[model samples]
Target: MISPEERNRTGRGCLLGNWVEERATTSLDKTGPESDIHKKGHQGILTVDWSSKLEDTSTQKSAFTSSKGTSAQQKGFRYELMKEHLIKSISEQVHAELTAKPAAAELHSVTRRDYTAGGFQWVRPTPSTDRDYKTDQAITFWRENFDKIQGVTAVRNRDAPFKKNASFTCPITECLDPNPENDLDTEEK
Candidate 1:
């Protein structure tokens, strides 16, 4: 079967997923009150009931980010959350950002350092002969170190673009004097 992309491009084949909607709300929902009750028949027989009582929707609503993301799109970013060191420029900036736009901290989560850090990016075994390399130098480095990078020794899904679910992505990255140097001020964990 021809995909949606081919159908859209060629303009000759029939497509089932053709209709596009500006607004996703249903006809019944748009007509009147937006109550939680769901009716199946014409007599308005209630077909659904809430399993758990929701006193407030604040927790659920905070999970969604309404704003369209920024220029830091697709790029891996490093941000600092201010707690102890108020003297640093980035820490002060982060606090200021949260103060000005409180909604910026929505969907914020604490993650493990080793899991998300780039230092642990290539922990898997060496790539097989079937895998494709991004570049000659990259392949050479991988083969020598027995390390493989994504979209090179491994495949990356090319369907839809990946997006960060967090709001207010600050492009600011604070490094010491040099980009490669580690901060000497950090305490031992």
Candidate 2:
């Protein structure tokens, strides 16, 4: 009594449900192909063609071999088919298992502003001179004042405050002190 559209939808839904069920129940082994085939309730046999589903036919054939030389072709066919079926079923199970779990918590940005300055600095010592006395004295002066020059350079290269924390008040409103004066301890008069 169902309309054609309704029947089609129901059929598709049933097919999907059966496919999922088959993927879940199928054993991950190539021992037998007949065991992998499922019979849907009153909806005909669902014969999974594992060999045809494989992307590379030659690879599949080369990966498996049969002991029976005379009937090798037939045995190889069944073996490849069963192997593909087992691989597909196992992959589906793993995919389902991975997707079922809750997603990992998102990482929050931990970036903070560098308030204090005066970090370590490295400077290449100026090349010394062997020819002139005045030039050698100038090089010696440069070598002696290198640390002071480096310190000055460090002060000049201080990192600018992050835009989010540029204000005098605390960036986090909840953690802000009600009386800002209490933050700095005063000597008892």
Candidate 3:
């Protein structure tokens, strides 16, 4: 004997551990609005055909299940695309290098001396002695005229030489200067 206000508050009736609401037992009537069937349909009692919903869900599940195949195909396509791009870039670089002129620093010719048994052995070339005859003659002329050059001779006694001067005598020697005035001036002040 619940009041309408109490029924509205609880939204439905509960009796003996079972739902006693009339809406809970009523089957969905197809003649009703399509939106009412979806909103108010009771579980196991709804007259609405669920096979269509099941079909839609199965199609979605199938799409999800086949994702592995699609992903593999996508990966293979991406790999081939990347490989083609790399090859094209490499070929372009090689073509550019081939068409470009060699730099001045890289254009020099390298003389490689191969030390292999059958290869030509490189040796230091010696200049001919005939071309240097003037140098040798000059050296010989200097050697022959060395004794003729006027050079100072070494004296046996450094204190006495071949030519003696009055200035060369010791300060104490009276023969250095006979002038008594010059001798007195030569003494320490």
All candidates: TM-score: 0.11, 0.16, 0.16
| Number of clashes found in candidate 2 | 0
| Best-to-worst ranking by lDDT | 3, 2, 1
lDDT tens digits, residue span 100-121, model 2: 9788987655532344346846
Candidate 2 positional error at 35, Å = 76
**What local distance difference test score does each model get?**
0.40, 0.50, 0.52
Tell me the spans in candidate 3 whose CA falls farther than 4 Å from its real position. Answer: 1-75, 104-189
Evaluate residue 60 in candidate 2 and report its C-alpha lDDT on the 0 to 100 scale.
65
Q: Which candidate wins on TM-score?
A: 3
State which candidate, 1 or 2, has the greater TM-score: 2
TM-score of predicted model 2?
0.16
Question: How well does model 1 score by local distance difference test?
Answer: 0.40
lDDT of 1 by residue, 1-189 (tens): 444354245345434343222122233334443343234322222334446454565866778758886767563333233423445877779888888844464453556533466555556777766544553233344444432344332111121112232223533352123522232223212
